[model samples]
Target: MTAQALPPVVDAETWQRRLDELRAREKQATRQLDAVAARRRRMPMVEMPGYTLEGEEGPVELADVFGDKSQLIVYHHMWFPGEKWQCPGCTGFTSQFTRLGFLDGYDARFVVVTQGPIDEALTYKRRVGNRMTWYSTANSPFGAAVGAPAGGGFAVNVFLRDGRKVYRTWHTDGRGTEQLGHTFGLIDVLPYGRQEQWQDSPEGWPQSPTYSRWAGSEDIAARYGPDGGTA
Candidate 1:
Protein backbone atom coordinates (compact mmCIF):
# COMPACT_ATOMS: atom_id res chain seq x y z
CA MET A 1 0.00 0.00 0.00
CA THR A 2 1.11 3.57 -0.71
CA ALA A 3 2.03 5.60 2.37
CA GLN A 4 0.52 9.02 3.08
CA ALA A 5 2.77 12.04 2.43
CA LEU A 6 3.67 14.60 5.09
CA PRO A 7 5.64 17.81 5.48
CA PRO A 8 9.33 17.34 6.13
CA VAL A 9 10.46 17.32 9.75
CA VAL A 10 13.04 19.89 10.76
CA ASP A 11 14.84 21.04 13.92
CA ALA A 12 13.09 23.51 16.24
CA GLU A 13 15.24 26.45 15.16
CA THR A 14 14.75 25.74 11.48
CA TRP A 15 11.00 25.39 11.87
CA GLN A 16 10.79 28.58 13.90
CA ARG A 17 12.82 30.50 11.33
CA ARG A 18 10.66 29.28 8.45
CA LEU A 19 7.47 30.08 10.35
CA ASP A 20 8.68 33.57 11.20
CA GLU A 21 9.39 34.26 7.54
CA LEU A 22 5.89 33.08 6.53
CA ARG A 23 4.33 35.16 9.33
CA ALA A 24 5.92 38.33 7.94
CA ARG A 25 4.33 37.69 4.54
CA GLU A 26 1.03 36.87 6.19
CA LYS A 27 1.09 40.20 8.04
CA GLN A 28 1.71 42.04 4.79
CA ALA A 29 -1.27 40.29 3.21
CA THR A 30 -3.42 41.32 6.15
CA ARG A 31 -2.44 44.94 5.64
CA GLN A 32 -3.24 44.70 1.96
CA LEU A 33 -6.72 43.42 2.86
CA ASP A 34 -7.15 46.40 5.15
CA ALA A 35 -6.20 48.75 2.33
CA VAL A 36 -8.68 47.14 -0.01
CA ALA A 37 -11.42 47.48 2.56
CA ALA A 38 -10.63 51.18 2.90
CA ARG A 39 -11.09 51.57 -0.84
CA ARG A 40 -14.39 49.66 -0.71
CA ARG A 41 -15.61 52.05 1.96
CA ARG A 42 -15.10 54.93 -0.43
CA MET A 43 -16.55 53.24 -3.50
CA PRO A 44 -19.39 54.94 -5.37
CA MET A 45 -22.75 53.15 -5.45
CA VAL A 46 -25.52 53.06 -8.03
CA GLU A 47 -29.11 53.92 -7.22
CA MET A 48 -31.43 50.95 -7.65
CA PRO A 49 -34.94 51.24 -8.99
CA GLY A 50 -37.85 50.36 -6.76
CA TYR A 51 -39.32 46.94 -7.56
CA THR A 52 -41.67 44.38 -6.00
CA LEU A 53 -40.49 40.94 -4.87
CA GLU A 54 -42.26 37.80 -3.70
CA GLY A 55 -41.54 36.99 -0.10
CA GLU A 56 -42.68 34.05 2.01
CA GLU A 57 -45.47 36.37 3.17
CA GLY A 58 -46.36 37.32 -0.39
CA PRO A 59 -45.52 40.48 -2.34
CA VAL A 60 -43.10 43.06 -0.90
CA GLU A 61 -41.06 45.98 -2.16
CA LEU A 62 -37.30 46.51 -2.43
CA ALA A 63 -36.88 48.24 0.92
CA ASP A 64 -39.11 45.72 2.68
CA VAL A 65 -36.44 43.00 2.38
CA PHE A 66 -34.24 45.01 4.73
CA GLY A 67 -36.85 44.64 7.46
CA ASP A 68 -36.10 47.53 9.81
CA LYS A 69 -32.40 47.58 8.97
CA SER A 70 -30.76 50.18 6.75
CA GLN A 71 -28.20 47.73 5.39
CA LEU A 72 -29.09 44.60 3.43
CA ILE A 73 -26.84 41.78 2.29
CA VAL A 74 -28.45 39.56 -0.27
CA TYR A 75 -27.07 36.24 -1.47
CA HIS A 76 -28.22 35.71 -5.02
CA HIS A 77 -28.61 31.93 -5.11
CA MET A 78 -28.51 30.33 -8.53
CA TRP A 79 -31.78 28.53 -9.34
CA PHE A 80 -32.94 26.10 -11.94
CA PRO A 81 -36.56 26.46 -13.10
CA GLY A 82 -37.66 22.84 -12.54
CA GLU A 83 -34.78 21.14 -10.80
CA LYS A 84 -35.30 19.33 -7.50
CA TRP A 85 -32.04 20.74 -6.19
CA GLN A 86 -30.46 24.02 -7.16
CA CYS A 87 -26.77 24.59 -7.61
CA PRO A 88 -24.93 22.26 -5.22
CA GLY A 89 -22.08 24.75 -4.83
CA CYS A 90 -24.43 27.60 -3.97
CA THR A 91 -26.50 25.37 -1.74
CA GLY A 92 -23.46 24.29 0.26
CA PHE A 93 -21.76 27.69 0.42
CA THR A 94 -24.84 29.52 1.69
CA SER A 95 -26.14 26.87 4.04
CA GLN A 96 -22.98 27.25 6.12
CA PHE A 97 -24.16 30.70 7.20
CA THR A 98 -26.65 29.52 9.79
CA ARG A 99 -26.19 32.46 12.13
CA LEU A 100 -26.66 35.76 10.30
CA GLY A 101 -28.93 37.47 12.80
CA PHE A 102 -25.83 38.88 14.49
CA LEU A 103 -25.68 41.29 11.55
CA ASP A 104 -28.34 43.21 13.43
CA GLY A 105 -25.53 44.49 15.62
CA TYR A 106 -24.34 46.40 12.57
CA ASP A 107 -27.85 47.54 11.57
CA ALA A 108 -27.76 45.01 8.76
CA ARG A 109 -29.84 42.03 7.66
CA PHE A 110 -29.04 39.05 5.42
CA VAL A 111 -31.41 37.16 3.16
CA VAL A 112 -31.44 34.96 0.09
CA VAL A 113 -32.84 36.13 -3.22
CA THR A 114 -33.44 33.64 -5.99
CA GLN A 115 -34.80 33.73 -9.54
CA GLY A 116 -37.12 30.72 -9.19
CA PRO A 117 -40.76 30.87 -8.19
CA ILE A 118 -41.51 31.41 -4.52
CA ASP A 119 -42.74 27.92 -3.73
CA GLU A 120 -39.87 26.17 -5.44
CA ALA A 121 -37.29 28.42 -3.88
CA LEU A 122 -38.62 27.97 -0.37
CA THR A 123 -38.84 24.20 -0.79
CA TYR A 124 -35.26 24.06 -1.92
CA LYS A 125 -34.27 26.34 0.92
CA ARG A 126 -35.62 23.94 3.53
CA ARG A 127 -34.36 20.91 1.69
CA VAL A 128 -30.85 22.30 1.59
CA GLY A 129 -31.06 23.31 5.27
CA ASN A 130 -30.95 27.04 4.61
CA ARG A 131 -31.71 29.17 7.64
CA MET A 132 -32.21 32.51 5.95
CA THR A 133 -35.60 33.19 4.44
CA TRP A 134 -35.76 32.92 0.65
CA TYR A 135 -37.40 35.51 -1.57
CA SER A 136 -38.38 35.04 -5.19
CA THR A 137 -37.35 37.50 -7.88
CA ALA A 138 -39.11 35.56 -10.62
CA ASN A 139 -41.38 38.45 -11.46
CA SER A 140 -39.08 41.31 -10.55
CA PRO A 141 -36.48 42.98 -12.71
CA PHE A 142 -34.29 43.40 -9.62
CA GLY A 143 -32.39 40.15 -10.11
CA ALA A 144 -31.20 41.05 -13.60
CA ALA A 145 -30.71 44.67 -12.63
CA VAL A 146 -28.30 43.53 -9.91
CA GLY A 147 -26.37 41.27 -12.33
CA ALA A 148 -27.75 37.96 -11.01
CA PRO A 149 -30.14 37.02 -13.75
CA ALA A 150 -31.66 33.53 -13.87
CA GLY A 151 -29.24 30.76 -14.88
CA GLY A 152 -26.35 33.23 -14.85
CA GLY A 153 -24.77 31.97 -11.55
CA PHE A 154 -24.65 33.24 -7.97
CA ALA A 155 -23.60 36.54 -6.44
CA VAL A 156 -23.21 38.46 -3.19
CA ASN A 157 -24.72 41.92 -3.42
CA VAL A 158 -24.67 44.61 -0.76
CA PHE A 159 -27.31 47.33 -0.64
CA LEU A 160 -28.07 50.35 1.46
CA ARG A 161 -31.45 51.96 2.00
CA ASP A 162 -32.18 55.54 3.00
CA GLY A 163 -35.88 55.93 3.68
CA ARG A 164 -37.45 54.32 0.58
CA LYS A 165 -34.50 54.84 -1.76
CA VAL A 166 -32.10 51.94 -2.35
CA TYR A 167 -28.53 51.87 -3.66
CA ARG A 168 -26.17 49.02 -4.47
CA THR A 169 -22.87 49.47 -2.65
CA TRP A 170 -21.01 46.40 -3.84
CA HIS A 171 -21.34 43.22 -5.88
CA THR A 172 -19.12 40.14 -6.03
CA ASP A 173 -19.35 36.91 -7.97
CA GLY A 174 -17.12 34.08 -9.15
CA ARG A 175 -13.93 33.80 -7.11
CA GLY A 176 -14.45 37.28 -5.66
CA THR A 177 -17.09 35.85 -3.32
CA GLU A 178 -14.85 33.05 -2.00
CA GLN A 179 -13.83 34.89 1.16
CA LEU A 180 -17.44 35.09 2.31
CA GLY A 181 -17.50 31.32 2.85
CA HIS A 182 -15.71 30.11 5.99
CA THR A 183 -14.96 26.65 4.65
CA PHE A 184 -12.26 27.77 2.24
CA GLY A 185 -10.47 29.94 4.80
CA LEU A 186 -10.47 27.15 7.35
CA ILE A 187 -9.28 24.60 4.82
CA ASP A 188 -6.58 26.89 3.50
CA VAL A 189 -5.07 27.06 6.97
CA LEU A 190 -4.68 23.30 7.24
CA PRO A 191 -1.39 21.63 6.31
CA TYR A 192 -2.88 20.31 3.07
CA GLY A 193 -4.32 23.70 2.08
CA ARG A 194 -7.39 22.45 0.19
CA GLN A 195 -5.35 19.74 -1.55
CA GLU A 196 -6.98 20.83 -4.76
CA GLN A 197 -5.51 20.12 -8.18
CA TRP A 198 -5.33 23.80 -9.07
CA GLN A 199 -3.29 24.90 -6.05
CA ASP A 200 0.49 25.12 -6.12
CA SER A 201 1.76 22.46 -3.71
CA PRO A 202 5.01 20.63 -3.21
CA GLU A 203 5.57 17.30 -4.97
CA GLY A 204 4.00 14.17 -3.35
CA TRP A 205 1.29 16.34 -1.70
CA PRO A 206 -2.24 14.95 -1.79
CA GLN A 207 -4.46 16.59 -4.41
CA SER A 208 -7.82 16.21 -6.06
CA PRO A 209 -10.11 17.99 -8.52
CA THR A 210 -11.04 21.58 -7.75
CA TYR A 211 -14.21 22.00 -5.62
CA SER A 212 -14.21 18.24 -5.00
CA ARG A 213 -14.74 18.93 -1.33
CA TRP A 214 -18.49 19.44 -1.75
CA ALA A 215 -19.19 16.19 0.06
CA GLY A 216 -17.72 17.58 3.24
CA SER A 217 -20.00 20.61 2.98
CA GLU A 218 -22.96 18.36 2.32
CA ASP A 219 -22.47 16.91 5.79
CA ILE A 220 -22.60 20.45 7.19
CA ALA A 221 -25.76 21.32 5.27
CA ALA A 222 -27.53 18.13 6.37
CA ARG A 223 -27.21 19.22 9.99
CA TYR A 224 -29.14 22.46 9.38
CA GLY A 225 -32.59 21.06 8.68
CA PRO A 226 -35.55 20.86 11.12
CA ASP A 227 -34.62 17.44 12.42
CA GLY A 228 -31.41 17.79 14.44
CA GLY A 229 -29.10 20.81 14.65
CA THR A 230 -28.54 24.24 16.13
CA ALA A 231 -27.17 27.24 14.29
Candidate 2:
Protein backbone atom coordinates (compact mmCIF):
# COMPACT_ATOMS: atom_id res chain seq x y z
CA MET A 1 0.00 0.00 0.00
CA THR A 2 1.11 3.55 -0.72
CA ALA A 3 1.37 6.21 1.98
CA GLN A 4 -1.01 9.16 1.93
CA ALA A 5 0.83 12.37 1.02
CA LEU A 6 0.47 15.72 2.76
CA PRO A 7 -0.20 18.92 0.82
CA PRO A 8 2.91 20.92 -0.09
CA VAL A 9 1.73 23.99 1.81
CA VAL A 10 0.23 23.62 5.28
CA ASP A 11 -0.09 27.07 6.89
CA ALA A 12 0.84 27.66 10.52
CA GLU A 13 -2.80 28.20 11.39
CA THR A 14 -3.80 24.92 9.75
CA TRP A 15 -1.01 23.06 11.49
CA GLN A 16 -1.98 24.42 14.90
CA ARG A 17 -5.61 23.61 14.21
CA ARG A 18 -4.71 20.02 13.34
CA LEU A 19 -2.59 19.66 16.48
CA ASP A 20 -5.39 20.98 18.66
CA GLU A 21 -7.85 18.58 17.12
CA LEU A 22 -5.59 15.61 17.71
CA ARG A 23 -4.93 16.61 21.29
CA ALA A 24 -8.65 17.01 21.95
CA ARG A 25 -9.31 13.57 20.55
CA GLU A 26 -6.49 12.09 22.58
CA LYS A 27 -7.90 13.47 25.82
CA GLN A 28 -11.40 12.23 25.03
CA ALA A 29 -10.10 8.76 24.22
CA THR A 30 -8.11 8.63 27.45
CA ARG A 31 -11.17 9.39 29.55
CA GLN A 32 -13.23 6.79 27.73
CA LEU A 33 -10.54 4.18 28.31
CA ASP A 34 -10.23 5.12 31.96
CA ALA A 35 -13.95 4.51 32.42
CA VAL A 36 -13.69 1.16 30.64
CA ALA A 37 -10.71 0.19 32.81
CA ALA A 38 -12.69 0.86 35.96
CA ARG A 39 -15.06 -1.81 34.74
CA ARG A 40 -12.25 -4.21 33.80
CA ARG A 41 -10.77 -3.78 37.27
CA ARG A 42 -13.69 -5.75 38.57
CA MET A 43 -13.09 -8.76 36.35
CA PRO A 44 -12.54 -12.12 38.08
CA MET A 45 -8.99 -13.16 38.85
CA VAL A 46 -7.20 -16.51 38.33
CA GLU A 47 -4.76 -17.91 40.85
CA MET A 48 -1.33 -18.12 39.21
CA PRO A 49 -0.29 -21.27 41.13
CA GLY A 50 3.44 -21.60 41.80
CA TYR A 51 5.63 -21.22 38.68
CA THR A 52 9.39 -20.89 38.16
CA LEU A 53 11.61 -19.13 35.65
CA GLU A 54 15.30 -19.46 34.85
CA GLY A 55 16.90 -16.20 35.87
CA GLU A 56 20.51 -15.18 35.50
CA GLU A 57 21.38 -16.74 38.82
CA GLY A 58 19.07 -19.75 38.61
CA PRO A 59 15.47 -20.76 39.19
CA VAL A 60 13.31 -17.95 40.52
CA GLU A 61 9.70 -18.14 41.55
CA LEU A 62 7.19 -15.94 39.82
CA ALA A 63 6.25 -14.25 43.07
CA ASP A 64 9.87 -13.57 44.02
CA VAL A 65 10.61 -11.94 40.68
CA PHE A 66 8.41 -9.00 41.58
CA GLY A 67 11.16 -7.84 43.96
CA ASP A 68 9.30 -5.70 46.51
CA LYS A 69 6.48 -4.72 44.16
CA SER A 70 2.88 -5.85 44.39
CA GLN A 71 2.03 -5.87 40.69
CA LEU A 72 3.84 -7.55 37.81
CA ILE A 73 3.78 -6.95 34.08
CA VAL A 74 5.25 -9.73 32.00
CA TYR A 75 6.01 -9.54 28.30
CA HIS A 76 5.99 -12.92 26.58
CA HIS A 77 8.98 -12.07 24.42
CA MET A 78 8.92 -14.00 21.11
CA TRP A 79 12.02 -16.07 20.45
CA PHE A 80 11.61 -19.62 19.31
CA PRO A 81 14.31 -22.26 19.64
CA GLY A 82 15.49 -22.00 16.06
CA GLU A 83 13.55 -19.14 14.53
CA LYS A 84 15.46 -16.09 13.37
CA TRP A 85 12.57 -13.66 13.84
CA GLN A 86 10.73 -12.79 17.06
CA CYS A 87 7.28 -11.26 17.18
CA PRO A 88 7.46 -7.65 15.99
CA GLY A 89 4.75 -6.46 18.37
CA CYS A 90 6.38 -8.13 21.35
CA THR A 91 9.68 -6.54 20.46
CA GLY A 92 8.00 -3.17 20.26
CA PHE A 93 6.42 -3.66 23.68
CA THR A 94 9.76 -4.77 25.10
CA SER A 95 11.46 -1.68 23.76
CA GLN A 96 9.11 0.23 26.04
CA PHE A 97 10.04 -1.99 29.01
CA THR A 98 13.24 -0.11 29.79
CA ARG A 99 11.13 2.27 31.79
CA LEU A 100 10.02 -0.49 34.15
CA GLY A 101 11.06 1.11 37.42
CA PHE A 102 9.30 4.31 36.44
CA LEU A 103 6.14 2.24 36.60
CA ASP A 104 7.33 1.17 40.05
CA GLY A 105 5.65 4.23 41.51
CA TYR A 106 2.46 2.28 40.86
CA ASP A 107 4.01 -0.82 42.47
CA ALA A 108 4.78 -2.79 39.34
CA ARG A 109 7.68 -4.96 38.21
CA PHE A 110 8.09 -5.59 34.49
CA VAL A 111 9.93 -8.57 33.07
CA VAL A 112 10.37 -10.24 29.68
CA VAL A 113 10.06 -14.03 29.40
CA THR A 114 11.29 -15.83 26.33
CA GLN A 115 10.72 -19.39 25.13
CA GLY A 116 14.24 -19.96 23.89
CA PRO A 117 16.16 -22.58 25.79
CA ILE A 118 17.57 -20.93 28.93
CA ASP A 119 21.12 -20.34 27.78
CA GLU A 120 20.05 -19.37 24.30
CA ALA A 121 17.81 -16.67 25.71
CA LEU A 122 20.66 -15.17 27.77
CA THR A 123 22.97 -15.25 24.78
CA TYR A 124 20.39 -13.63 22.54
CA LYS A 125 19.83 -10.79 25.00
CA ARG A 126 23.52 -9.95 24.90
CA ARG A 127 23.57 -10.14 21.13
CA VAL A 128 20.56 -7.80 20.98
CA GLY A 129 22.10 -5.49 23.63
CA ASN A 130 19.11 -5.38 26.00
CA ARG A 131 19.73 -5.07 29.76
CA MET A 132 16.17 -5.78 30.76
CA THR A 133 15.44 -8.75 33.00
CA TRP A 134 15.35 -11.51 30.39
CA TYR A 135 14.39 -14.96 31.64
CA SER A 136 13.41 -18.38 30.29
CA THR A 137 10.43 -20.58 31.11
CA ALA A 138 11.91 -23.51 29.23
CA ASN A 139 11.50 -25.74 32.26
CA SER A 140 8.26 -24.33 33.55
CA PRO A 141 4.61 -24.06 32.49
CA PHE A 142 4.34 -20.24 32.60
CA GLY A 143 4.66 -19.43 28.89
CA ALA A 144 2.09 -21.88 27.44
CA ALA A 145 -0.28 -21.71 30.40
CA VAL A 146 -0.59 -17.95 30.40
CA GLY A 147 -2.05 -17.24 26.89
CA ALA A 148 1.27 -17.05 25.11
CA PRO A 149 0.18 -18.64 21.80
CA ALA A 150 1.49 -22.07 20.74
CA GLY A 151 4.71 -21.06 19.05
CA GLY A 152 4.89 -18.17 21.56
CA GLY A 153 4.72 -14.35 21.76
CA PHE A 154 1.25 -12.80 21.76
CA ALA A 155 0.64 -10.99 25.03
CA VAL A 156 1.76 -8.57 27.69
CA ASN A 157 0.16 -9.61 30.95
CA VAL A 158 -0.35 -8.00 34.35
CA PHE A 159 -0.77 -9.85 37.61
CA LEU A 160 -1.65 -8.65 41.08
CA ARG A 161 -0.72 -9.81 44.56
CA ASP A 162 -3.18 -10.54 47.35
CA GLY A 163 -1.33 -11.50 50.53
CA ARG A 164 0.67 -14.56 49.49
CA LYS A 165 -1.46 -15.41 46.46
CA VAL A 166 -0.96 -13.98 42.99
CA TYR A 167 -3.58 -13.54 40.28
CA ARG A 168 -3.66 -12.60 36.60
CA THR A 169 -5.39 -9.34 35.82
CA TRP A 170 -5.06 -8.22 32.18
CA HIS A 171 -3.26 -8.67 28.88
CA THR A 172 -3.07 -7.06 25.41
CA ASP A 173 -1.93 -8.18 21.96
CA GLY A 174 -1.89 -5.44 19.36
CA ARG A 175 0.21 -2.69 17.84
CA GLY A 176 -0.26 0.99 18.73
CA THR A 177 -2.86 -0.18 21.22
CA GLU A 178 -0.26 0.12 24.01
CA GLN A 179 -0.32 3.92 23.97
CA LEU A 180 -3.72 3.72 25.65
CA GLY A 181 -2.16 3.30 29.09
CA HIS A 182 -0.58 6.05 31.25
CA THR A 183 1.13 3.77 33.76
CA PHE A 184 4.43 2.67 32.17
CA GLY A 185 7.15 5.30 31.67
CA LEU A 186 8.92 6.07 28.40
CA ILE A 187 12.63 5.34 27.85
CA ASP A 188 13.29 8.45 25.81
CA VAL A 189 11.46 11.44 24.47
CA LEU A 190 10.58 10.36 20.97
CA PRO A 191 11.14 13.44 18.80
CA TYR A 192 9.67 11.82 15.68
CA GLY A 193 6.56 10.49 17.39
CA ARG A 194 6.21 6.72 17.03
CA GLN A 195 7.56 6.93 13.46
CA GLU A 196 5.37 3.97 12.59
CA GLN A 197 3.73 4.12 9.18
CA TRP A 198 0.56 2.35 10.30
CA GLN A 199 -0.59 4.45 13.27
CA ASP A 200 -4.29 5.29 13.41
CA SER A 201 -3.91 8.95 12.56
CA PRO A 202 -4.09 11.42 9.70
CA GLU A 203 -1.55 11.24 6.88
CA GLY A 204 2.12 12.39 6.81
CA TRP A 205 2.70 11.67 10.51
CA PRO A 206 5.49 9.23 11.46
CA GLN A 207 5.24 6.21 13.79
CA SER A 208 7.96 3.64 13.98
CA PRO A 209 6.66 0.15 14.74
CA THR A 210 7.56 -0.46 18.41
CA TYR A 211 10.29 -2.96 17.48
CA SER A 212 11.78 -1.47 14.31
CA ARG A 213 14.71 -0.10 16.30
CA TRP A 214 16.01 -3.57 17.13
CA ALA A 215 18.86 -5.10 15.13
CA GLY A 216 17.84 -6.67 11.81
CA SER A 217 14.18 -6.00 12.57
CA GLU A 218 13.78 -3.31 9.91
CA ASP A 219 14.03 -6.02 7.21
CA ILE A 220 11.91 -8.37 9.31
CA ALA A 221 9.06 -5.88 9.03
CA ALA A 222 9.23 -3.41 6.16
CA ARG A 223 6.35 -1.24 7.44
CA TYR A 224 5.25 -2.51 10.87
CA GLY A 225 4.78 -6.05 9.59
CA PRO A 226 2.51 -7.26 6.73
CA ASP A 227 -0.76 -6.14 8.33
CA GLY A 228 0.49 -2.90 9.97
CA GLY A 229 -1.10 -0.48 7.51
CA THR A 230 -4.58 -1.83 8.23
CA ALA A 231 -6.76 -0.81 11.14
Predicted structure with the largest TM-score when compared to the true one: 1
RMSD (Å) per prediction: 2.8, 7.6
Model 2 per-residue lDDT tens digits across residues 38-101: 9888888889988988998999988887888899878777775675455555554455434555
lDDT of each: 0.85, 0.67
Q: Lowest lDDT 10-mer window, candidate 2?
A: 182-191
State model 1's lDDT: 0.85
Residue range 1-231, candidate 1, lDDT tens digits: 753888899999999999999999999999999999999999999888888999999999999999999999899998878776568788888887878878889999988999999988887777657888789999998999999997888999999999999999999999888978788899889988988898999888899998776654345446666633232
